[model samples]
Target: MSSPLKSLHFAVFPLPAQGHMVPMMDIARILAHRGATVTILTTPVNAKRFNSVIERAVEAKLKLQVVELQLRLAEVGLPEGCESLDMLSSTDPWFKLLGAFDMLEEPAEQVLRRLSPVPDCIISDNFIPWTSDVARRLSIPRLIFHGPGCFSILCMHIVTSTSVLDGIESDSELFVLPGLPDPIEVTKLQAFGQSKPNATKPQVSDNSEAKTKEKKGYIERVQEGEKAAHGILVNSFEELEPEYAHELAKAKDKKIWCIGPVSLFNKSDLDIAERGNKAAINEHDCLKWLEGREPGSVVYVCLGTLTHTSLEQIIELGLGLEMTDLPFIWCIRNKTEELERWFSESGFEERVGDRGLIIYGWVPQVLILSHRAIGGFLTHCGWNSTLEAVCAGVPMVTWPHFADQFFNEKFIIQVLKVGVRIGVEIPVVMGGEDTAETLVKKEEVKVAVECLMNGGDEGEERKKRAQELAEMAKTAMKDGGSSIRNTTSMIQDITEQLAINV
Candidate 1:
């Protein structure tokens, strides 16, 4: 059959966050490779970051382009160079950044208008719901790209749509989420953005109330935009969560495309190494460090980019890593001067000696996870990390921090049986002061790591299941695989819908 994607043009816009942007870029590459012309729309700083990916795609002769939209941070009352969320110092600027993103709609629409071949589809990050408006004006279909997997989205839908939380009084009380293939256990605390009921609440500052209103307005728009969109494009595969994927489609009443483990699209070593930000450690150095270790002997720890660890939490985590006495590679972020002082005074570097390698910033996560020496992962259960660990056949020690991570942890530990939780219950908002007290202590961390890394019947069984999932992930990306078939079907359906609208 003729490729439905042939000569089609797609406009891709991703939110300027690590987790959201990376997968959307992968999706763009996937579409270009599938014979669709793709244009990635973003601000100047983000456009610069896409240079490497764009260059590689161009070299391979894929029809991909990037259009830069300069963000007016001053107009939005945000600092200059605050193009991405990571650049912010506090949560205060978050809403302002969202406001700045709103200013881009006109420029983006104009850019779309001037393209030689108008885009047939607009695939934008879920946060940028105004793209639905752009699609409406241009008379093209819009598809929302949800960063999390089908299961998490389903859980979120249930929390919002069903009476699941009607009588839940305590944060730690467990409840079974209704309408799923498996009875997934979830605490009220695990619900994303679930507000706490304080008996004696502090008076809300006028400024805080304004910010809350702005946030609420933005969230409502996003929900409405998602409903108005033609469908959803998720970074998941059918075999990975067939029932949940189908259920999510039914719940949303939209055609959901599970075309993922999208990281697999990076076939070359250079692509893998340079997938996200430039690696703090060289690919050769990282591989050399793992070369002498025995297979399945090392534990790789990284809590993702967005999460911040307090000095107290860092000390506890460091202590836990020391207690395990296993070969490890930990990628840490937000290295404060106090943390450095503690590292120096605590003799952490001298004690661990050559047994542990600490990367202070970005490391090539995908490459490290795929290494043979990687036995277990200490992760925050972000969708990317969870899916990457599954793809690499590495069992996880899940320590979910917030957002969809809690749901992801359950899916990893309960559904897949290839992970162990570190016993964190309460969902934390970013930049909250109470994080130090709520974090998993050293004992919990040590025990979970030991359980995952040490070889036992249970550990071996987990390894077996992980390897099975890895094989499934590989098959799903191959020719005639579930993910590939989904992609083809999505393109064909979009084409039919566009024709009907015409």
Candidate 2:
């Protein structure tokens, strides 16, 4: 990697979702730190949410610009204001959302061309496979950014594409895939057994558009696009998956950069530096609940934005948390009426009282995890939440639901050894098979929580491992850390290319 300070602008395009937005914002910041101006390509609705973050970064003197593509719901045949996948009431419109992503290619390309420096490259989310062609059209290098660890990437590639689990027919039947650093016993439930999964991990069918009618599925197109990319930048570090990092790069024969848990370097962290890794939380009342609790006593429960559970399951989950008798902060982001209906009918709110704090919207996840009261995370095992739990050093009660999350749970339980498996394998979203009978019984949830927070030798050992991982994540982003070195090398490589292009 060359060290020439060539001025190269970057266009960081994120898939229009909270999970995609938050991590890519950090990537923009990382590039800005390397002396490059970055423009975040996103939707108008998402832009409004990002304005505050962008404002904060600019306040901290970072060269960050946000360019919104005109993705309106009605224009794309979606409901009004339903720009993000999470914004939708049900996952049925997910196909429309995928189609909408293709619609933004032209608008995104326009932003890239209109920029003064014309941008050196397009760093896009893996979901937006169309951007690789957009980069080709503009004759610029393109890279796909994955918001997961190296282990999750490996599992995603292997579990879905390989015949590794051919023999396992039952849901709990465990088998190990070939070529991983360690043995991971995955169940048939881990597979995309939930109806027909499209090209990407779980699946979403592409709408009838000539542009996307490649005979191949969306995920296949993404893979092909990535194969032609300059590199794949993952939100991970060498310390976590050192062997897999080298193995994946050698296997793909592409320049892979380990430049994350990128969220660690946000300007928001500077304000909370004195308070540790706490970010700003939407619900301030959760903090008050935590004030009286002991350190490592409260359970932090949240099934990410997209996961949807039936009202029955919500009742069971609420009861399960209540049964654990441990103070908890449960963050649920389903429609307000349903959440209220279930909680009211079940007397869940009255039962828990001050013991459990339920937030109906997105709270400051990282900030909450860094709180003194949070001891365990009941998570869906999405990579962002998974990485956040790792960074916070809290043991996870792994309950994976969708996408590469099952594999992420495998990484947390098998590879990282910092989380415990609760065997709640099905996604909450309705559409698949009848899983009502298999809903994680309250006893199962109770036992899982007990296994994580109970004062047992195994639980204590897991807690110790989680704390060790937290320390490694903390040190890896410091001045001389491996992640820092990789980030510097990545920027240098790009600037070197820009020098040649000119």
Candidate 3:
């Protein structure tokens, strides 16, 4: 029989953030591999990041393409190049970025209307909930793409769907998240929108209040969009979090297709190394560094793209890594001149010397994690980073900065037992300023690293568990695996629905 996805067109929209856009691109490629004609909707700046992947897809003769839309940045009072989250300044208000995303709706609708074969479905990032409306207007099914795993999604859903936060007195007060397969303990801050005790709230002027109100509406619309969509496309596999996955599907009453660790879909070395951005360090140089280290003897440190680490924290981290005396590869993003000056003046780099390799920009994180020498990862616990580490069977030193990261850390440390936390007590959202004042000192960092990488029964067990999950992750992508079956079912369901509609 012919593939159900054959000739079916899918217009995929990803929110213009690294975490959001990367997986959505992977999903687009995955769908095209299953014989679907996939068109990715992206902005000019965001589209450039996917050039390599898109080229490879086309070269492989896959029916995949990217449509770059000119976002009305000036109309929204955003700067010309402020298309993605990483491009946003610390001073830029969050609502203005949302306004820029709002501007894409009209152009997106126009593009969808003009496509040669009408899209059978709209697969969109959960953040860009406005795409649901575009799907509605175009009379196509919409599938929400949730980048985080079922654990985080389930926690968020339970908290949002009910008045769980009603009458909560303290941000640190723990409550069991109701209606979950497991009694997951969560604090108000952990859930969402809770503030620290005696914390000075941002002074909201009338104009700022209006913008805040608008942002609230945007969040509500996101939830509404999910409710209205036909299903959710999660970058996860059933074996990874079977209970949470089952619980989430039951709670949402929506078709939840867990088709991921989507990075695995890219089999070629070039595709793997160059998955997101061109490697800042040469891929060969990175591999050469790893090759020199003994098996499971190196610590890989990367705190994801959006994390803004202060120089003080960097020095502390540098000291901690130096203290470990382990072979290490650390990738630093958003490197400031002050950071460079510190490295030059303090001789910190010289002290670490050949024992440590630091890439001051983007590194091929997945490639590095999969290396045999990588013993552990010191990470900010971003979902993409978390999933990548899990697939590589590498344990983590969790230091979550913001968004769903804290929840993801819980899943790693508590549920999976394959990681340890570095004791970041409060969550900090990116507002373009130094939000991560809850600095984890050097002692905590050193201890966490030792706990995850050192020779102890606990450490050995963590490694064993992580390896098991990694095998399961790889298995899920193979034929008859959970992910492959889910992908087929998703396509078949979409095709059957379209037939009924026709």
Candidate 4:
């Protein structure tokens, strides 16, 4: 050695959602373990969430750093609370996201400029395009991390370039996607029939006509910014989606690395039970509840933070679970008052009694999945949940709600064959002027739960597949394995590129 191979400085910008933040944190941890000086930049809110994980990492001697960037919108004339992606979801989501990037550009630049030794490379979320510009201005290499599956990223590229958004009629299925191996249904798209025709950016003028024009102009600019990014990083393993990842690489003439199942890599850095926001939930109560249960007997149910079901639907689900009579740990957010009220009124708490545990607010999802008692997951098919379930060797009962969840459900049931769909029919409403429709009844729920709990021909097959995928996930994270190799290669590539430019 040449100076014992000095550690490189890498900056990460994660999308402000729990799903995005978790995977990005995993990547940050891996880099830190490999002796890279990592700085994770998040908003004040997300920074607080990151503190627990950072503390855990530091305890393990990972040498990770967390930086909180306060986002101000007044100077940019953008709406308040536009600093993070979560704040912009309801109000002009796309533009607010762009505005967030604009807001971060100066602050990020100042932070990097002030550093004694500049960051060797900047890693950014692909969804936010402003990082590319800042990296260019600083003459630093930018690596764009796609926080979703490779197929999802490919779909985004196709939708943006082919004007698919402009042509999509309400409820019309986009049967043929350009780059995908199989046709993707339009309804399954992330925007969920919301991508308007000629949907452009907001205009500078206060007048309606001028605003429409400005909106279009702004959208065009955002698209161009995304296209000009330096390189792309995907949160997926090549073995899982080889064909899709290859297609993405060829579509964008930039270096693409598939470093994923990031949650698996995180296991080595921190205890599973210690991974969540402690302030949000009672981890001790959750673990104690799981401790009494037999191995591979409980069902873990979570619909993620964004997917909200109606009161009637929640009641239906509760009844279904009750009917199944399975030991369950259901993660319910505080917002589901209707469901909570219904449970109270229906004697649901007494019905399940000691057999069920309802965790209100945030749950330590990774811990729950990894527990010995968790046999199957009743999921909403969020990519992060899917990956975690896979890592934990847990089969699933797919109940997709919205966005790319439908696509993920298809992948899990159709492609992977590691889980069973809850049922094709939508859930029916009961009583109170609610229209009764075809629903996955309590009977079907019972059958699925039984199959998952007690091994049968089909259940055994699914169990075997789930176990195989879990092993694959484990192997991918081991030394010199796909995930580790890809992460190491990415760091080396960035370091080399920086050296060449210098």
Most lDDT-accurate candidate: 1
lDDT per residue for candidate 4 within 1-502, as digits (tens), equals 0111448888888876666777777788878877887888877777775677788789888768887787665654556655543333222333444555557778878888877577888887765567778788888888877656877667667766675555556443535665578755544233331222233221122337755665566556556655776677777788777888888888876777888787776553234544534425566777888999999889998877654355656667777888877899887654555665677787989979999988776778888888888999988787889988988889998876544565677678866787887764232111111124434466777766666666578888888888888888887777767877777777778778878898
Q: Which pairs of residues clash in candidate 4, taking residues 3 or more apart in a chain or in different chains?
A: 174-186, 200-215, 200-216, 201-215, 201-216, 202-214, 202-215, 203-214, 203-215
Residues 1-502 of candidate 2: C-alpha lDDT, one tens digit per residue: 1222655688998887777777787778777876678888877787877666677778878778987777645755787667777776553546567677788878778878888978888899988899999988877888888767787777667766677766566666667778878977666656553433332344443445553454356768888897888988988888888988987887668888887777677535333221211233433555677889999999999988777666667777888899998999887765467767777777777888988877766677777788878999999888889988888889999887666777788888888888877776554332222257457878888989988999489888899998888888878887778888887777778777666766
Which prediction has more favorable lDDT, 1 or 2? 1
Q: Using Cα atoms with residue i matched to residue i, what is each candidate's TM-score against the true structure?
A: 0.96, 0.90, 0.96, 0.84
> Which of 1 and 2 is ahead in TM-score?
1
lDDT for each candidate structure: 0.86, 0.75, 0.83, 0.69
When sorted by lDDT, best at the front, the candidate numbers are 1, 3, 2, 4
RMSD after Cα superposition, model 1: 2.6
Candidate 1: residue 2 Cα off by (Å): 9.2
TM-score of predicted model 2? 0.90
Evaluation by TM-score, superior candidate among 2 and 4? 2
Q: Count the backbone clashes (under 3 Å) in each candidate.
A: 0, 1, 1, 9
* Per-residue lDDT of 287 in model 2: 68
Candidate 1 per-residue C-alpha lDDT over 1-502 given as tens digits, one digit per residue, 9 for 90 to 100? 2255556899999998888888999999888888899999998887776688789899999999999998999997777888886666544445677789998999999999999899999999989989999999999999999989999999889987788888888878888999988989888777753225221111122247676667677888999999999999999999999999999999999999999999998998888988877788898999999998999999999988767677888888988999999999999977789989999998999999989999988789999999999999999898999999999999999988767888999899888999988888776654332275477788888999999988599999999999999999999999889899999988988899899999
Tell me the deviation in Å of residue 403 in model 2: 0.6
Per-residue C-alpha lDDT of model 3 across residues 52-131, encoded as one tens digit per residue? 88998999999998898887888877889888877776666556666788878988889988998979999988888889
Which residues of candidate 3, in runs, are more than 4 Å off? 1-5, 193-207, 433-437
